[model samples]
Target chain A: MNVVDLIKSYGSKTVVKEVSFTVPKGKVLSLIGPNGAGKSTVMGMISRLIARDAGVIDFEGQDLTKWKSKELAKHLAILTQHNNVQMKLTVRELVAFGRFPYSGSRLTPEDNEMVDKAIAYMELQEYQDQYIDELSGGQRQRAYIAMVIAQDTEYVLLDEPTNNLDIYHATNLMRIARRLCDELGKTVILVLHEINYAAFYSDYICAFKNGRIAKFGPVEEVITKETLSEIYKVDFEIMNIGGKPLTIYY
Target chain B: MNRAKMHRRNVTRLALLAVMVLVAVVFYLLVNSHPEKPKLFQYILSLRLPTLLCMIIACISIGAATLIFQSIVNNRIVTPALLGMNSIYSFLHTAAVFVLGTGSTLFLNANLAFAVDLLTMGVVGTLIYWYLFKKTGHNVLYIMLIGTVLSSLFGSVQSAMIRVMDPNEYDALLGSLVADFNNINGEIILFATIMLLVLAFVLRRELGLLDVITMGRNQAINLGVDYDNVIRKLLFGVVLCMAVATATIGPVSFLGLIVANMSRQIFKTYKHSHLMVGASLMGMLALIGGQMISQHLFHFTVPVSTFVTIAGGIYFLYLLLFKKGAY
Candidate 1:
């Protein structure tokens, strides 16, 4: 997927301006930036969750806007932050909703098989019957991810998937994102606040600063202290951990 | 719980509610018929049947409307009554009597009045929802707030009109203001039933997406449900149902709130197909039981809405205080 010259403005304030990037297939790309840097806005625009004022997004050599929403949903799935499900839904019921794009409320045998696989993938088998509201934060996040997985889309977009999760669960989620690309050959995009997780788990990192791309390259090229300090407006020291660059900012 | 077990449980609960409705219907139909006076028994049955049909239609419409409205707004505490549809109904009747002197064709002709009321309410309600949603970018809270404000605005205007009007005109207007099961016209009931059937036919396809809508706007859109279009269609259906039921049998404010919540609590499921059915059954049971009690126990001294309002008010309080997070 390639996005060229994207622009979005809320009233008088332009949140995203002249942003451009290309996503490699079957690889993980993380959008990392400080608050108000337009990473999420870019993500939202890319997934068509938020309308763009001006842009051209080429998905498989076709304009993204030309793709029908239902047909596009078959190839791409997105999980936004703050998924507060108000209804009383079981884990199984929630995951089954992932098959809605295919079966639409009536889960065929194949849809059920995909739901089962997603449930097992998320390791939520024991809690499949448990109500979502009764689960812990991390478990509920996993259930949502499982739903996205069950969508069986080749391109997955996760906006701040690690929000409100503990470090252990956050790391676990990162590993799952890695496996989603490495094992399943799905292209994944993420909006992340933790730069280290982006460096360690993602193959490419796009850093946003003030609604424009500060740097976009491989992890090794973009995870340097100079680029981190320049983008975040803070001093940064870098250390190698597990053969990946980790940032220590002050 | 396993899926099969949950399915069985929901079915059993629905069956139990159905049986309760049946018992209420039978008791309502046969309890006071005098066997000694056969002619009187037949006359009473004839009188009672239309009222039964009106109550059934009103309850089903209110129940289904409330459930669907709640799902679209993604809120369990609200009902279509909050949209000021009932207030509009009362306001229209009061205005008609006040301006037209209670002798106009719109005031005296039940069928014509029913058509006018339904049309006015449906159009006005749809306009309010459509305009506000467009202006506010589909914010449910803004629509609800505007609805509450409009309700009070109409209520103030109606009461002001009622106070200065002739006592005879006020008396004529009183029947349409409060819900009265005994005085509904047979023709109006038939009209409402036909309108309801049309609405049911139009909304059958959209009703299938109610479960997806319960997941909220973003998820529904992500699942390719065409959130805005579906909401528009469903909200229009809600307006029609509310208008038809209110115009046919007057406005029963709290019945929808009571029945919809009770169904959700009992079924404990997100699928609106089950929720709508459960709510309709519970609504039928409530209306039938309330009418029976008003006839037999209270000897027609108390109106059925009195029972529903008081019970529903107390239940609303219980839901607010005790069942805060359960919904």
Candidate 2:
């Protein structure tokens, strides 16, 4: 995926401006920034959820806008931060919605296999028959991710996938995200508020400050004290946790 | 969908359909049972046919329209009546009576006035919603907000006109405003049936999309449904159905909400096909059953609207209080 000079504005306020980045195949790219830093906006633009004012997004050697939405769903999928649905759906039913673009909500054997595999991957097999609203915050988040996994696209973009998750589930989500890239060979992009999770799990970290990329590089390069303090405007201390650089901003 | 679960839901729906048909039969015979006139069969056909037809059309249109509207808006509590069709109808009726003194030919000729109501409200009401949907960028909340304001505006204007109007005219206006099964126009029923048929045909394939839509806008888009186009079309369909029912039957605002909620509660699935049929049957039952009660027990002294309003209002409160799940 390649994006150049991507721009989005609401009325007069430009939320995302001239953002540029590229993600290679089979890599995890983490977009990390504070609130109102435009990370989610950039993620939304790439997924085609939010329209862009001016930009060129190239996916798999074709312009993103040139692809039909249904055709695009075969190559890309997204899970927004808020996954609240008013319908009473089981986890299985919710996962089946992921196959809508392919089979139009009809479950062939292949679609059924994919749904089951996704549920297992997310460790949600025990809760497959449970209602989504009845699940805990972490479980619901996992179910949503499982749905995205069931979409089985080459490119998966998630905005704040770990928003309401506790620490253990949040870490598990990061591990699953990594496995999706390393094991399945899919390109993944995520907007994460937890800097440590991004620093630990992502191959590339694109930190944002004020609607623009402050730093974009390999994890080792972007997690430095200088960059972290500059991007977040906070006093930062770096510590090696499990031989990986983790930042502390308290 | 598990096999056993699907079978159970189907059986429940079938039972609902059976009840609707039975009630319809009773309603037909009940209305014509006591006629003491020559050419009794003709009296039954001519007199009761239009009322039955009107009830059926109102049931289908209002039931399906409300469910679809709730799906698109993602709110079970709000109905198409929130779009102010009733208020618009009231305002138009009051304005007519206020200006023409209720003795004009427009008031005397029921068919002409009914046509005028259907045409003006159909065209103008749909236009109002269409324009608002475009302006709000298909935001249901904003459309609903502006709709409430417009309804309030229409209500005030109607009340202001009613205040100065002659008492006799006010009495006539009140009768026209409340939904009455006996006051339907045959021509309007014919028009509504044709529209309903066309709508059903057009929506055959798209009805499946409602399950995805119930997931919410982003998921629908992710599922490759054209979120904007499909929603716009659905909104247009809802507006058309609502315009016909409100213009013809004078607006039973709560019938849709009542039946739709019941359908959702009973079906417990997201598929629109089942919900549409289930809600339609439930709506027919409500109208026919309520008509039976009002006509027989109350001797037609109580309006059908009174029964529906009280029952629907009570159910609405129940949903609000106990059913805290999503729409």
Candidate 3:
């Protein structure tokens, strides 16, 4: 997927300005930035949840806008940071919603198989029949991810998937995300606030500072002390942890 | 959360279904019963049959409209009444009486009057929703606020007109204002039934979409459902249902909120198929049950609307107290 000179503005204030990047297939790309730095906005635009003011997104040599939304659903799927559903649905039922584009809620044997596979993948089998509202924060987050995974899209985008998770759950989510790219050969894009997680699990990092891409490259090029301090306006010291760059900022 | 618990929930749904069927049977028997029995059965059938049909129409409209509206907005607390459709309806009723006089052809001809009501309310209803969308960018709270204000404005204007009209005319208008199945014209019931059927057929294909919509806008879009187009179509369906019902039977405000929430609690599912069916059954039961109580227990001294309000008001309060934060 390639985006060229993307621009998004709300009223007189421009949120994303002239951003360009390409996401290689079968790799994990992390978007790291501060709050209001346009990471989520860019993710939304790419997912077509938000319209772009200008630019082109080329997916499979076709303009993104030209692809029908249903067709796009088969290839690309997105999960926003805030997943608020006010309906009373159990975990199994919620995961089956991911099959809507394929069967429109009439679950075939294949759809049910995928739903069960996703439920087992997220290790949510115990909570599969539980109402989403009755689950803990971490469990609820996993249920949503399971829904996205069941969608079986080749390109997946998640915005801040670990907002309210504990350390163990957060690391578990990142590991699962890494396996989605490595074992499944699916391209993954994510917006992350934890620089350490971005450096640890991501193959590519795109750092945004003040609504513009400060730098975009491999993890080694984008997570250095100089780039980290300049983008975040914080003092940073880098340490080699398990042969990966980990930032120490106080 | 377990198989046993799931079984219990299913049992509750089955029990509710049984109760609805029992209530429907009782409603049919009661409507068919007459004091003269063998002699007056035909006379009673002529009168009560249309009234029964009218009751069905009201149930489908109010029940289906409220459930669909709440699902689209993803709020269990609010109904389409918040769109001020009921207020505009009352305004049209009062304005018709004041302008055409109670004895005039416009006021006395049920067919002409229903057409005027349906057309005016349908056009005005569409305009209000369109205006709200354009002005507020589909902000739920903003549209609700405007609807509340418009309701009060229509109420004040209607009261002012009623005050100036002849007392006899006001009395007749008052009878029309409070929803009662006894007074509905047979032609209007037939018309409403046809309209509701057409709407049902038109919306048959999109029934599952309502469930998707309850997942919120972003998720619905990501699932490949055309959010804006579906919403607009559903809004039109809502307006049509509300308009036809309001035109036939006067506005019953709390009934929808009461029954919709009850359906959700009983069904324990997000699927609109079950929710709509459950709510519609509850609506029919409430209207018929309330009518029976008012007719037999109170000897017709109290109106059915009074019974519905008292019962629905209590249920609303109970839900608010116990399930405060679900919305």
Candidate 4:
């Protein structure tokens, strides 16, 4: 996916301005930045959850805007943070909704197989019959990720999938993102707050600052102390951990 | 709940509602029949059949419309009546009587007035929904608020017109305003049935999207549902159904609320197909049962809406107090 000069503004205050980057296929890419730095906005634009004011997004050699919504959903799936489904849905039922784009409320055997596989992937088989409202925060988040996995898209965009999760579940979620890229051969884009998790899990890092791409490169290149300090406006010290650059900011 | 358990429960609930509707229909038709006088009984059956048909059509229209409306708005408490259809209905009737006078053809001809009411309410409701949704960027709260405001505006205008109107004309207007199954015209019932069936055929595809819509807009869009297009079409369908029901039997505000909420409570599922069927069945039972009481018990002295309002008002209060988060 190639994003060229994407711009978005909310009532004259531009949130994403002239941002340009290309995502590598079959790899995990993380967008990490300070609050209000337009990381989520860029992700939202790529997922078509929010409209772009001025830009060209070339996805698989076609303009993103020209792609029909239903058609695009086959190739891309997105999971935002606040999924407040007010209905009384079981975890299986919620996951089954992922096949709606394909079968539209009528699930074939193959669709049910996919749903079962997604639930198994997320280790949510025990809770498949439980109501979503009755689950814990971490369990519910896993249920949502299971739903997205059932979608079986080539590109998956997660906007802060770890929000409100504890350290154990957060780490688990990051590992799942890695497996999504490595095992499933899917391209993953994430908007993350914890720079450490991004540096650890993602193959590529695109740092944002004040609505612009501050740096876009491999994790080793973008996680350097100088780049980290410059993008986040803080002092940073980098340490090599298992050949990966980790940041310590003060 | 497990899938099998929930499915079984839904089936049981639906069967119960079906039986209730059947019992209501039987009592409505043959409760006080004079079997000894075969000719009189036949004559009474003829009178009751049209009224029963009218009630059934109105129930289906209101039930399905309310379920769809709640799904679109993603709220269980609010009904399609909040869209100001009822107010528009009352306003049109009062304006017709006040401006055209009771002696006018619009008032004298029941079919003509019914046609006018259905057309005006459908068009105006669609326009209001379209304009408000576009202007507010699909903010449902704003649309509902404006609907409430418009309802009060029309209500005040209607009352003002009523205050200065002649007593005889007011009497004429009163019969049309409150729900009355006693004086239903067979032709209007036939027209409403045809219109509803046509609407059902036209909106079948969109209706399938209602399950995803209950998850809200962003999720619906993410699931590859054409959010805006589907919503616009479904809301239009809702307006048409509301218009037909109100024009056919006048406004039975509480019937939709009662049946829809009861269906949701009983079924406890997110699928609109199940909910719609359950709601329509419950609506049939409520209206038929209420009509039976109004006819035999009250001797047609009380309108059916009175019983429905009292029952529905109590249920609404119960929902508000105890079942706040259940929906």
Q: Best-fitting candidate, measured by TM-score?
A: 1
Whichever of 3 and 4 has more DockQ, that candidate is 4
Question: How well does each candidate superpose onto the true structure, as a TM-score?
Answer: 0.94, 0.90, 0.91, 0.92
Candidate 4 lDDT over B93-153, as tens digits, reads 7887898888988778777888777777677777777778778875667878988998899
Candidate 3 docking class: medium
- lDDT per model vs. reference: 0.87, 0.82, 0.83, 0.87
Off by over 4 Å in 2: B1-3, B30-38, B89-127, B130-143, B157-179, B325-327
lDDT of 4: 0.87
CAPRI-style quality class for the chain A–B interface of candidate 4: medium
* DockQ, all models: 0.68, 0.56, 0.63, 0.69
Poorest 10 consecutive residues by lDDT, candidate 3 chain A: A79-88
Candidate 1, residues B54-172, lDDT tens digits: the string is 88888889989999988877778878796787887788767766777778888678778778777776777777777777777756788788889989999999999989998988887
Clashes of each: 0, 0, 0, 0
Off by over 4 Å in 3: B1-32, B35-39, B92-109, B130-139, B160-179
- Clash list (residue pairs), candidate 2: none
TM-score winner between candidates 1 and 2 = 1
lDDT, candidate 3, A1-250, per-residue tens: 9999999999999999999999878999999998888999999999988889999999989988898877888789898877777878899999999998899978999999999999999999988988999898888888988998899999989888888889998998899889889987889999999999999999999999778999999999998999999999999999999999999999
Model 3: TM-score, first chain: 0.98
Candidate 4 accuracy as TM-score: 0.92
- Per-residue lDDT for A18-100 in model 1, tens only? 99999988999999999999999999888878889998999988887798778888889989997888788999999999999
Better of 1 and 2 by lDDT: 1
How do all the candidates rank in terms of TM-score, highest first? 1, 4, 3, 2
Which 10-residue window in model 2 chain B sums to the lowest lDDT? Answer: B29-38
